[model samples]
Target: MKEIYLIRICGKCKKTNILINEEVEDTIKKGYYISCSHCGSKRIFKENETSDLRKCMDNNVYKRVKGKIRQVHSI
Candidate 1:
């Protein structure tokens, strides 16, 4: 199975891409929106939205997962 991360932008703050695991996928699919911890913006991103914010996570970032990340290596 392919792992997926949900990406979203804060409506009020318009910053930060919030990523959630499979556990929250049900709530999202049901039309519930997420709130920003900083600005309390209630927003929801679609399932297919793509963002580079995941690559910038300092703590959870990784170099390679079998093969090197294509875009990061290209740069």
Candidate 2:
């Protein structure tokens, strides 16, 4: 099966932070801190965060299908 991933969209500056399946699992396991590199918004990875991540992934898929992939700065 293909690996799944998520990209977190920063609420403040609308930047994206990519999180692989492994990373997402680790975050959920360890309860690690996640921050947006562009906007510096911080949050803990938990159940709610996972749902938000799913939403972000879904939005990305929708944008991709519509041929509207966003461009972000190099990290």
Candidate 3:
């Protein structure tokens, strides 16, 4: 299977390259938004939406397989 990488979208530039999930939450505190590395959009980390997302995988849409991940590698 092909390898897939994950990234959050840039609201301004609309670039979906790489993702860093709330990496700056500690420093920024509760009332702050993370900036996109490419376009500096301040909405990259939408806490409410991303809260229910699984950290092991990137996208919100996923399948509940009984065995291993269907097309994933390295667990």
Tens-place lDDT digits, model 2, residues 1-75: 644555666666665666666776787689776777666887423222343445544433323435765543424
lDDT score at residue 28, model 1, on the 0-100 scale: 66
Task: Give the lDDT of residue 45 in candidate 3.
Answer: 39
Query: Can you write out model 1's per-residue Cα lDDT over 1-75, one digit (the tens) per residue?
Result: 544555555565555454655646676698986677667766644433333556444323236657854222211
Q: Which residue runs of candidate 3 sit more than 4 Å off their true CA positions?
A: 1-6, 17-22, 30-32, 45-75
All candidates' TM-scores? 0.43, 0.46, 0.35
Provide the overall lDDT of each model, using Cα atoms, as 2-decimal numbers.
0.51, 0.56, 0.47
Please give the lDDT score at residue 45 for candidate 1.
Answer: 44
Worst ten-residue run, lDDT, model 3?
45-54
- The residue-by-residue lDDT of candidate 3 on 1-75, one tens digit each, is 321323455677654434334444444687665577766777663322234225534543345589644423222
Per-residue error (Å), model 3, residue 60: 16
List candidate 1 stretches off by more than 4 Å. 29-32, 44-75
Best by lDDT: 2
Question: Candidate 3 — which pairs collide?
Answer: none
RMSD of each: 8.7, 7.5, 11.2
Model 2, 52: alpha-carbon shift in Å? 19
lDDT for predicted candidate 2 compared with the true structure: 0.56
